[model samples]
Target chain A: MSESNLMMHHYLAKYLRQERMPHIWCEGCGNGILLNCFLQAINELNVDLNKIVVVSGIGCIGRVSGYINVDSFHTTHGRAIAFATGVKLANPELEVVVISGDGDLFAIGGNHFIHAARRNVDIKVICANNFNYGMTGGQYGPTTPLDAWTTTTPYGNIEHPFNLAHLAAAAGAVYVARWTSLHVRRLKASIIKALQKEGFSFIEMISPCPEIFDRYNKMGTAVDVMKWFRLVSQVRHGCDPAKAEITENEILVGEFVDIEKPSYGRLLREMTSRVQDKLKREES
Target chain B: MVDESRAVLTGTHFMSGDLACAEGALAAGCQFFGGYPITPATEISERMSRRLVEVGGVFVQMEDEIGSIAAVIGASYAGKKAMTATSGPGFSLMQENIGLAVMTETPLVIVNIMRGGPSTGQPTMPGQQDVMQARWGSHGDYEIIALAPSSVQEMFNLTIECFNLAETYRVPVILLADEIIGHMWERVKIPPAEEINVVSRKKPKTPTAEYQPFKPDKDLVPPMACFGEGYRFHATGLTHDEKGAPETVSAEVQTELVKRLADKIRKNAEKIVKAQRVMLEDADVAVIAYGIPSRAALSAVREARKKGIKAGLLRLVTIWPFPQELVSDVAKQVKAIVVPEMNYGQLVREVERAAKTTPVILLSKLGEEPHRPSEIIEAMRRAVK
Candidate 1:
């Protein structure tokens, strides 16, 4: 067996839920795929799983924590990031991972997502971008393709979907990338890199939800969803997201930027040290 | 009304419940607060912000309730006993991560000055509709300690108790003061710090390497190691193993984890519960009151005594656990019990079950106006008859 696959099996056996053997993720729902990739990466890094905190918010993607066997927090609709931020700050040494859906991350929790990214807190954020809110039936989300059919927006949507990469990149995320679930190996590799990177790393995985987004949009099962992702994904690093758009319907998929910035914790310590030093000098 | 002839010291100040809730939090050694200004609880956020700054603590008015709770949690992790207060609408916004504070076993106090609403029902008005919601608002079956103080003094004292219970159990404790208690002001004693037994969270004495965030110790709560302590540990909302990580999805880990989280509060119910009883001895009938309505009831109970009615008042200091067992005991002696609250009938339901021998009387002032003692006196008299 390939080393990555072998490692995944061991980790899955040691940590994953074989009982919920088949997760509720759509047949091709990249959520399980992305979750698998994340687990694989956690193992690859050989992170003490005990010291790894996984927090998820609401939506199909929010169930990621329930599926995994870790110190996991499945929070309310959009507060996973906030909760994750609290857990991370409360114990900065723990590797905090926030996994959620596009809607859970941006729409309800948009404020927290921006602030965390802007502060560059040490968090690895993986958002499963299915272009719709999957769990509550198909509802148009911030990432839902404009004109997509969902429960809320029966007519073709006029609202432009948020390019998540653009949002994170603009919000000062030091490490930002987008990848399709089809690129499992690459997705796993990016998760590893994101975990290892010292600042806020946002990796958007464009998974498809067939039952809701697909059925209403007249697309077929999970296979068809994966096939579509395979057909129209692109990537370019250090390029403007506006320019990196594929055909209007498709999303770009690849690591856009992986540069380092001083983390908030480091800054806090440095400031503390500087103040102490100044105090000592003055006393002397 | 001339107090200059009085020998005893007194501050007969009139304030709303919102002001008292903030003052109570300040007395609790809360060093950090993050909240957005929302009705019925706006004054709390405002007072905490000003006082926190004055005391070298922090008060960040975040973008919203979600951010407010996040910042408060962050400050706590930074080694400060942090708190946040909000009413119904803002309280709804904070539920997502409030559960996180539950799972991570993060010790912080949330003052949910509950307002009227399933969603924004009574922002300016008062509502006692959040009692059930407070007990089970978030999506988990985990236990939480909630205190409902009747007077400004209880508000001040119980806020400290909430903080102590949060630290003692290493879980989030809710100060379920209503909009009435949050705004209504009364003279409260600021006891000397040493006089109040403060229980700080267990700090890791062992090396950071040996620290397990959720290790079930003797107290059913593990010692917490904060950030910058060099202790590496994971805290999550996931169903985790003792070490606080995602564990192998085994029945054993799930059972053990859930049990410890629950047992901490359940086992220590005596230490966590608080209440006040007035003139219970030799009383044939009683009135149960909590939050601001109880203040009115206290006056009414006193008035009834003057009129030769053998009535006493039982103030619920700790609302959750319902003082259920306490009320049950009181139920046996009283002919009928009167539960007068601001809402339609929140606590009276608990009273009915507790007081099986007595006909539970409910005096509900469901509208925006506060429940006055005159109304409670009438209920107490009717129940006695």
Candidate 2:
């Protein structure tokens, strides 16, 4: 590629760690598309890059933290949300975001996810729901669809999958949305909305794990999976997230919940100020 | 920044060891506390929840010990002095993230108020069983500083020391208290803020463009750069080079990084290690102990001296990077060493390792009550024989 063509095509180059580029994502993996959408969202917002800290847990999507140019942390498996909570609560001025995988966010880290959402911490969570544990060779995970074939589930996945949108909404996320990797523009728009929200916001990006999960489940090639996403996707704004489940025939996509309340950091600051004022009055 | 006046609690007061530990953290300028409620350590969290507010700090009661430690590490990386308190079971849950803190070189403190446990063997009782786990709990080759406080005063003083060691070395420091000291109410003198010694993590002096997050100075410890510092650096649990990018496949990177993580504490063990030597100047028998058992060991040493047995005490204040030189020196002079622990013999193994040819007697006690002075004195008598 010529320098001019490279400059034109890789406009989001500034948002990535160029030295670490040619990421670890497999060929035809949707992780790149998801990353592109996220970077585009960040680019469109034009926020101070210094203030953003991206944290990720263990998985293919977890590598996103390492690839991002900002101050990032690739934390332990299933701990991105918990770690992000600490970061956001410690310094409210820093915009803490967690980008991790389904197994990381739900299976091993399920309790932390719910509790962080329940506390309404002011952090954005972007979960790349590739449906199985992609990094660990497509073992079945918490979000693995029932009857889906995986490494651990040779015959079929018997475990019930979590409807992540419903889980986020039920666990008290102030903003919730879901989009497949095929919906690039809409996903980018939704990411921007989630980023702008003041309280806990969650956006589930249904990505394709072509080399591992799709291969085991016979979902054809990565492009074929993208076509499958297009065939089944339906946009529903402000619908009850409880009704938004990903079945073979239909995958509910779009903004399902958006509301506002005092975030954990805001309430903590309020309480601290109130207590400090009380102490002052007592001393005086 | 904390208002120094509100933080110190600056006076003599009667309080439990757990409360004193919390107050000590406040005095040390700890601005973030993430913890879970567990036996013998719950009071620390309760006190932190109330006091962290007055000092304008953040206190979060996480869902579990794993989340608590993870949050503590997160808060530390965001440039706050952070800590969490738990007992054995919770400490076990915290091991993985504790290792994460070690690899990422995040500074934090963990106070484990130990209870009897292979698995919840005792809850309302004291034990020194977690000492070995504190050293090797996380599955990796890294060194951590563990301080054992024997009294309410030491609980307060050593909790502050935990923070200082953690910040200065950029490693997780464990305050190994036990049920006896945690719940025991006693007088604690909180010194004025200016008189107190507090250490903060060293920040990078180099320009942002030239910064390498894991590049150490002559001290073998790197200057930390927190999130939102405009450094735009990245850190991970995976073995990485000086640049802090993940380099899992490189044998040299793994060797260099892991060795530094251990050597940062090992090379500076002399400065980090602390212990109280009592009457060991001319003694035939030496008693080695820590935490609650150290108090009994002290009493036993005095009792043995009264009986003309020439017994003395080597009370370990810093339990990890195991203080081998101190034990070896004492072992050479003494005829025999007596190790009385609350568990089925944890640190006794360390004493034996350090004692070399010197006979090391293990007086292992298991129960709700600590070893009686007579029991330890009896062991001292047998050791001298």
Q: Give the best candidate by DockQ.
A: 2
lDDT of 2 at B306: 88
Residue-level lDDT of model 1, residues A57-150, one tens digit each, is: 8778876776665556566667777766655654566788899988989999898899889888888899988888788878888877777788
Error of 2 at B210 (Å): 1.2
Query: Which digits, one per residue and each the tens of the lDDT, describe model 2 over residues A197-268?
Result: 899999999988899988888899999999999999999999889999899999999999999899999999
Error of 2 at A224 (Å): 1.1
Please report how far candidate 1 places residue A132 from its true position, in Å: 5.3
TM-score of chain B of each: 0.90, 0.99
lDDT of 1 by residue, B42-143 (tens): 788887755554444455566788887876765576567888888888878778677778877888888887777768687877778788777777887788
